[model samples]
Target: MDVFEALYTTRAMRRVKEDPIPDNIIKSMIDSAIRAPSGSNRQNWKFLVVTDKNIREKLSNIYRETWDYYINSFLNSAKDPGASSLKKQNDKDIETIRRISNSASWLAENYHKVPLLVLALSRNDPTGSSIYPAIWNLMLAARGHGIGTCLTTVMSFETEKVFEVLNIPNDKGWTLNATITAGYPLGKWGVAERKPVDDVTYLNTWGNKTNWNLEQPLWNY
Candidate 1:
C-alpha cells in the first residue's frame, strides 16, 4: 500500500474478524516497527506477540478488569461537578464518545477471540515518548497489510498480573507501555475523517495561522 494511503486510513480499528494472522505477516510488522527510531538509538523495547489461547484468555480477564475500572472511574468523575476535567459535551461529541466506548467495551469482552495481541514493553522510559512511536509503526505496518489493529493502554494498570500470566520477568526496569490487538478487519477500510491539519497546526508563532485557505485534502486517491 502507498505510505500516504496507509497513513490516512490507519485509524484505531477495534472491530475485526476472528481470523488467524500468519507468522510472516506478524514478523514483517515487527520488522517495520523496529526500524522506527527510539531515543538515542537505545532500542530498549520488546514486543511480545501473544497467540496462545490460554495466555490470551488470562490476559483478557486482566484487560476487562482494568477496562471496567477505567470506564467507571471516568463516569464517576464525569458526574462530579467540581473535579471533572470533562467539558460540556455537545451532542456530536457525546455520540462519538459513546460509539467509541461501546466498541472498546466490545473488544475487551472479546479480546481472546481475536487472532493476535502484541504487548509493547519499555525499559527506562518514563515519559513514554520513546516507545509509542514504535507502537505506531506496528499499527501503520498492519494497515499496509490490510490488517486491523487497536492500540490500547488499559492493560498497563494490570502489568503485574500480565507479567505473571505471560511469564514476563517481573523486573524493576520493565514497564508495559501498550497492547495492540490485531486481525483482518470485519469493517470496510477508508480514509479517516479528522479536523483539518491547518486547524491543529500553527505557523512560526503560536497564534499565527497559515493563510493557505485549504478545505479539502490536496491529493485525491
Candidate 2:
C-alpha cells in the first residue's frame, strides 16, 4: 500500500472480523513501530501482543466496564440535552462525535471477539511523546496489510487490573499508554472526513491564515 494511502485511510476501524492476523504480519507491525523515533532516542517501549482467548475475555470485561463508566459519565455530565460538552459544539461536530461514539460502543461490546490486542507500554516518558509515534506506526503498518486497528485508552482506567491480568510487573516503571485492537476490517476502508487544512493551518503568525484552501484529503485510497 502507498504510504499516503495508509495515512489517509487509517481511521479508527473499531468494527473488525474475528479472523486471526498472521504471526508474521503482527511481527512486522511491531518492527515498523520500533522504527519510529523515540524521545531522546531512549527506545523505552514494550508491546504486549495478546492472542489468547481467555486473556482477551478478561481484558474485554475490564474494557466493557470502563467503557460503560466513560459513557455514563459523559452522559451524566451533560447538563443540557442539547449540549454535550462545557463548550457547545455545532451540529456537525456533535454528529461526528455521535458517529465516533457509536463505533466505540460497538468495539466495547465486541472487544473479546477482536482477534488481537496490543498493549503499548512505556517507561519514564511522562508526556507520551516517545510511544505515540510508535503506536501510529503500528496502526499504519496494519493498514498496509489490509488489517484494521483501533487505538483505545479506555483500559488505562483499570491499570492495576490490566497489569494483573497480563502479569506485568507493577514495581517496574511501565505505564500502559494504549491498547490497540487489530483484526481484518468488517467494513470498507475510505478517506476519513476532516476540516480543511486551510481552516486549521496558520502562517508565521498565530492568527495569520495560510490561504492554501486545501478542502479535501490530499490522497484517496
Question: Residue pairs in steric clash, candidate 1?
Answer: none
C-alpha RMSD of each candidate structure in angstroms: 2.0, 2.1
Model 2 TM-score? 0.94
Off by over 4 Å in 1: 84-95, 219-221
lDDT of 2 at 181: 97
**Which runs of model 2 end up more than 4 angstroms from their true locations?**
80-92
lDDT (0-100) at residue 34 of candidate 2? 96
Steric clash pairs (candidate 2) = none
Model 1 lDDT per residue over 124-161, tens place? 77777788889999999999899999999999988889
